[model samples]
Target: MARTTGSHSDITGPRVRAAALSLFAQHGFAAVSMRQIAREVGVQAGALYNYTPDKQSLLFDLMQTHMSDLLSSRDKLPETASPLEALETFTRFHIRFHSERPEEVFIAYMELRNLEPENFEAIEKLRRTYEDQLENILRAGVSEGVFKVADPKLATMAVIAMLTGVNTWFREGGRLSLEEVEQIYWDMVRKSVGA
Candidate 1:
């Protein structure tokens, strides 16, 4: 099919993904269809093929982009002098980052079962890399005799699960501000690792 008049891939491509993300987050991957995404994007159903080969590919791309942005943002955080400081930074960062993108977080966690085997592996690798950052911090603290974690790996997962759990209950103007929530979580995390 010929390209739609006045349509640009640069602009429409992101709209397509955004629409898919929103729909997937709202209705789930198995329930959502490319035609629905195209309608949400204000394009014809067939137009979506210009951007993604299939719904599975679109889902994979959304997940991949989320993980990539997460890693990139995390890598930019300034280095800290001690494992204690690093752990604090990571605890706050994870809460802040995941909370801000609730839809992406929801889809990333909820839609994993829908991913194809290879895509699932790829996303899992990225998640492990992020988790490894926290694990390494726990390891460093253990080596320095600051953190009393019995198992750095277990502590990493626990801390991350605790931090990410904030998103499920957090709202912008609720009982606690995000900063306050961050501080509360930081304190819990510090004690969890015996820092």
Candidate 2:
């Protein structure tokens, strides 16, 4: 079983989660089985049950972990940062993080439909938390006259959609470095808000 404490267990959970995330991303949740995930993780099929009770639980766990990591990482940013700084911080962090964990991003976005109704609601709540963070930054920028967006919520969704779309075409040897990509996105986002 994957324990909650210790470095060893910590590593195991992420490894299992990553394997599951990649599989789910490549094949929709309904098409993936515990055996498939175990094969990817190099464990016996039955051993997969040690980490999660069932397939739905595994999907929920993956989404929960991804959401929690995102929120926790965002929460670590400097609290007193300006609105523009906050948005930039979030944008840069998101771009870099998603680049490093494309499978998780894919699973988070695509496999949401596989969740049971209760699980879906819980995941949606966590998702809204992340969205609210972006909205908060946008609202702050509008309040301080640094940004001129008419609707912070709509603006937040637009920026997130544009930023997340990078995962679709981004390649390791692409012409643009991650920093350059982030800068391009930052420019577009800033201009979109009338910064």
Candidate 3:
């Protein structure tokens, strides 16, 4: 057994997840094998077992980690910030974060069918928690007469879908910088919310 130690083990997990996510996104989850993931991670097939019990567990871990990081980041927004400011913060964060981790975002959105029912439910719940934060901000804005949304929930989904779509087209060598992309998204989001 190749015993991974120290920071290497910690680094290996994310690297493996990233590789798995990219492969799974390119070739449907059902088409991927543990050996493939292990190879991509530059480890022996059996070595992957040291990081995750099985393929399903690996998928679950990826989604769970992404969602957890998302929620934690959103939760850190300043409490005194206005709903519009919060929305702006969310918009910028969503674009920048997703842009940097497109593979993870692609996996999270595309590999839902591969997870078992229990794992799927857990991931879905975490996703909703993040969505709810945006909805709550929209609702608060509407209540304060700062936003004019007909349905905060639907608007929340629309905004997120639009923002997340950025990862699909954004490239490191793209003409617009990440800051510019964020500003464009922030403008669209503000307009959509009537902020």
Candidate 4:
């Protein structure tokens, strides 16, 4: 396809992804059509092909982008920091990050079964990388005798599940602020690990 000077992929690409993310979050991956996504982007359906080849590719891209952003934005816990400090950082960061992108987070979990095998593998790999960050923190904390976790791997899964569960029920003005929620989760995470 010939490139048009005004129809830039840089601008349209993200819009396409965002539209797809919202649609897939609102309707299951099986239910959302490329034309609906194109409408959401205010472009013709054919224009969507300029950004993604097909719906499967678009879903994979959304998931890949979500996981990539997750890995990139994760806190870089310093070696000098204590296990408790590292854990608190991870806990708070996890809650806040997931909360900020409820749609992406929702699709990330809800649409996993929709991914092709290769795409599923790629997303799972990125998920493991994110999980490993906390696992290492837990291991370090245990080694330092600051945490009494029975299994770092299991604890990593538990902490992530507990933190992510917040997005399902949390609202900005209903009861507590996100900061307050983070504090409460931090306390629970700390005690769960016996910090």
* Estimated TM-score for each candidate: 0.94, 0.88, 0.89, 0.94
In model 2, which range of ten residues has the least summed lDDT? 1-10
Q: Which stretches of candidate 3 lie over 4 Å from their true place?
A: 1-12
- Global lDDT of each candidate: 0.92, 0.85, 0.88, 0.91
Model 1, residue 81: what's the lDDT?
62
Winner of 2 and 3 under TM-score: 3
Give me the candidate number with maximum lDDT. Answer: 1
Can you write out model 1's per-residue Cα lDDT over 1-195, one digit (the tens) per residue?
677644678789889999999999999999998889988999899988988899999999999999999999973445656898888889888999999999999999999999999999999999999999889889999999999999899888899899999989999999999999999999999998887
| lDDT of candidate 3 over 86-172, digit per residue (tens) | 899889988888887777888888889888999999999999988998999999999999999999999999999999999878887
Error of 3 at 40 (Å): 2.9
By the lDDT metric, which is better: model 2 or model 3?
3
Q: Write the residue-wise lDDT of candidate 2 on 117-182 in tens digits.
A: 999999999989999999999999999999999999999899899888899999988898888999
Which prediction has more favorable TM-score, 1 or 3? Answer: 1
Q: How far is candidate 3 from the true structure (C-alpha RMSD, Å)?
A: 2.4
Residue pairs in clash, model 2: none
Candidate 1 similarity to native, TM-score: 0.94
What is the TM-score of candidate 4?
Answer: 0.94
